[model samples]
Target chain A: MQKTASITIRRKFRVGNLVFHVLVIAFALFMIYPLLWMLTSSFKPGTEIFKSASFLPETWTLESYTYGWEGISGYSFGVFLGNSLFVVALVMVGNVFTCSLTAFAFAKIRFPLSSFWFAIMLGTLMLPFHARLIPQYIIYNDLGWVNTYIPLVLPKFFATEGFFVFMMTQYMRGLPREMDEASRIDGCGFFMHYWRIILPLTVPSIITTCIFSFIWTWNDFFSQMIYLSKIETYTVALALRQYVDAMGNSYWGALFAMSIVSLMPLLFIFIGFQRFLMDGVTMGSIKG
Target chain B: MNGKRREACAGYLFMTPWLLGLFGFTLIPMLISLYYSFTDFDLLTPETWIGISNYVKMFADKKFVGSLGVTFKFVFIGVPLQLAFALLLAVLFKKERRGIRLYRAAYYLPSLFGSSIAVAILWRRIFNKTGLVNQVLALLGIQGQNWIASPGTALNTLIVLQVWQFGASMVIFLASLKQIPTDYYEAATLDGAGKLRQFFSITLPLLTPMVFFNIVMQFINAFQSFTPAYIVSSGTGGPLNSTMFYSLYLYIKGFGEFQMGYASAMAWVLLLIIAAFTGLIFGTSKNWVHYD
Candidate 1:
């Protein structure tokens, strides 16, 4: 009788575990189904996309890609992608280099009002970007930088984002001070220690900053929309908006196709560097 | 040079970029916005002293009030639901196992593209009358409306989209959960506490910090939410202005109508409101948030 009772309990436990796993898998599918639907719909014929409940395309074609690449007016979708990449690249470089340098200053160097300056920097994290939109627009307009990528890229070079600086500073403080002492005894100057010992040690943080910078810049819409008016200067976000506005239901196949294409690089980057991305986000959010 | 002198020089040199940005981009622009808020300056017209008229006028504007109401509803309802979903998922996925990473990635994917134009556009199609959501509803023998086009469901649809991207918060919650020592659970179990009881007594208390952080962050994001509403409504915030998010309304006022002063005033109000909410969170945190 005891043996039978034990067997029944074991069976029940196994069933419970199986149920949990099944539920988890179902929810995961729910989370990812829209993306799958979009991917399949991109290849489906225009009319069939709405009519079919199936994920598989009844008819597959490359017409959307061809039409989307041709783009609206004189500009091509290639131009949009190119513009996005260019801005993102420059922004990433700016963030990694400038944010680290600022962090290094706050972390390693002891100077007058350093704490005050650091406090100011952290405080800016709470300041909403929209609060400064009009003045920024005016300033950029005055400098003739409004239509160009400068408005998007220039601020990054200035380490306007304090989160990266804070992350790097925390990382630098955790490093062994013995290395700095050893470097100093070897006749290393401040810049020399930073270049040889510090910069290399902080590669993880820099890469983290780069990943975020790339993604944020790539996905940014408001600043790009406000600054870049010309179609040729439009980033993928703005270009996609144009398609939705102009075509509505007319070229949805093409719209879906381009949307998928726009998300491809981000998907690749995220999938490739998820470890760094996850680590960066988790570390960055930890009360810093 | 003396060590202090050398340190100061190096620090100043390294901080040059940020210092310049502080002055030019942040400080100066903030002062300018403050000045602009007091004056009636359109982008095209000359500035005229308004003397708090813009701030005063906001009280009478129905659209402004409606926008604030919509925003409040969104932040209160959407943020809590999103945070709850994130916490629940974090708890469910707390155990280590094979293939969890793939599941994590699949879940985190939406957040990575959460605010992207493409995602917003995809959301539009998914909620349309003949879209996937309605099709699924049809399979269940239920009728579905064109969710985005209707006044009643438009805002709720946007809120659902916000909640759907709860992955970022879930990850944070997972990290916080990991920080919690296992002894608490073991001790609770020794005291004859069940799984649900331990979760309430141990897990929830320990995860309060993360819960607080996610609430504040999600609240701020929901207030500033513009893209989904914009794309869903085709930038009109239409269907009788039900989907007119505060920021969208502000954008229309500033850029569309060229009411720069009015927009600046609105921006300042938003900043103050956000600051107040943040302050409230921090102030009340001592009561409920447990720290080790």
Candidate 2:
């Protein structure tokens, strides 16, 4: 009797496990379907997108990709892609260097008014971008930096975007301060210690910051739309918007295709460094 | 000779980039906008000081009032609904089930493309008059409106789009849920508590902090929502200004119309509104946000 009851309990547990697995798989599929639709639709002809259809493309073609890449009203996506890449690269570099340095000071260095300054920095996070938009526009205009990538990349160098600084500061706070003390005992100066010890050890945080900055800068449309005026200077985002005009005849297939292509780099980076992203987000929550 | 002074100097030096950027890019611009709010400073030539005229005009502007209403509608409605969905999904996936990682990644993919121009374009197509939504409606022998082109439905579409990107909040809640000890639930069950009762008695109370955090974050993000309305409405805030969000309106004033001073006033007004809202939440958070 005891053996029979144990077998029944084990069977019930197996059933429960199977049910949970099935539910999880269904939810996962639901989440991924939109992305899969975007990818598959990119390969389909413009007319085929609307046809109520299966997941696989019946008549797959590369025309949309080709058109999306080469055909932006007398200025190919190559230029736009290059412009975006350059801007994103600069922004990433500036964000990592400046944000990490400032975060280090906030996290480690003890000085008079440090807490006050930190409060001020945190306060800036609450300041809405809309609050300073017009004035910043005027300043950029006066500085003759309008219609350029300077506005996009320069603020990053200044730690004006506070989210990254905050994240890095939080991460840096959790790191062992004993490491800093030990390095100091070895006659290491602040810069050397920061460069050789702290920065290297903060790889996960750095990756997190880099991925975020890259994606944010890459996907940034408002700032890009406001600043970049010339067609030659347009980011891929701006170019995509400009591709569709008032006549309602957008290159839907090509647009979707380009969308997938544009997302590829970010997706690749995200998948490659997903562990860092997950850890960073979790750490951010704990700090909050 | 002085180690303290050297460290102090080094700290300030390390902070210089951010400081300069903040002061030059953020602080100075903010101050200038405050000053400009009282002036008629068009970007063309010089600032013509006009005291409170811009503010008075803004008060009478119908579009400003309408956009404010639209923004409030979005924030008040979209935020709670999004949070509820996120929390539900987080709870559902909070267990150590097989393929949980895959589920998490899939849910998060929307956030990756959430703010992309491509998604916006896709949204327009999906909700257009002859779009997939309409086709689905046709299958049901029902008629569907042009979601993007219709003023009534445009903002709603954007709200749905916002809710669809609940992955970030879901992830946060999932992390927070994991931090809750399983023993509490087990104890509740041992005490003859039902699953629902256990959730309310233990899970809900413990999850308050994350809920509060997500609400504040979502509110701020929703208030500043510009890209969807901008892209979907083709940067015109069209279909009779149905989708003309506050930020988009501000953009039109500053960039499109070149009313620099007036736009500055609008911006300051928006800042105050957000500050007030955020302050109200923070004030109330003490009662509901359980830290420990």
User: How accurate locally, in lDDT, is each candidate?
Assistant: 0.88, 0.83
Evaluated against the true structure, the overall lDDT of model 1 is 0.88
> Model 1 chain A, poorest ten-residue lDDT window?
A279-288
Q: State iRMS for model 2.
A: 1.8
Q: Model 2 reproduces what portion of true contacts?
A: 0.62
TM agreement with the true structure for every prediction: 0.96, 0.94
Runs off by more than 4 Å, candidate 2? A1-32, A51-56, A279-288
Please write out the lDDT profile of model 1 over residues B44-68, one tens digit for every residue: 7778998999999998999999999
DockQ of 1: 0.69
lDDT at position A208, candidate 1? 80
Interface RMSD of each: 1.4, 1.8
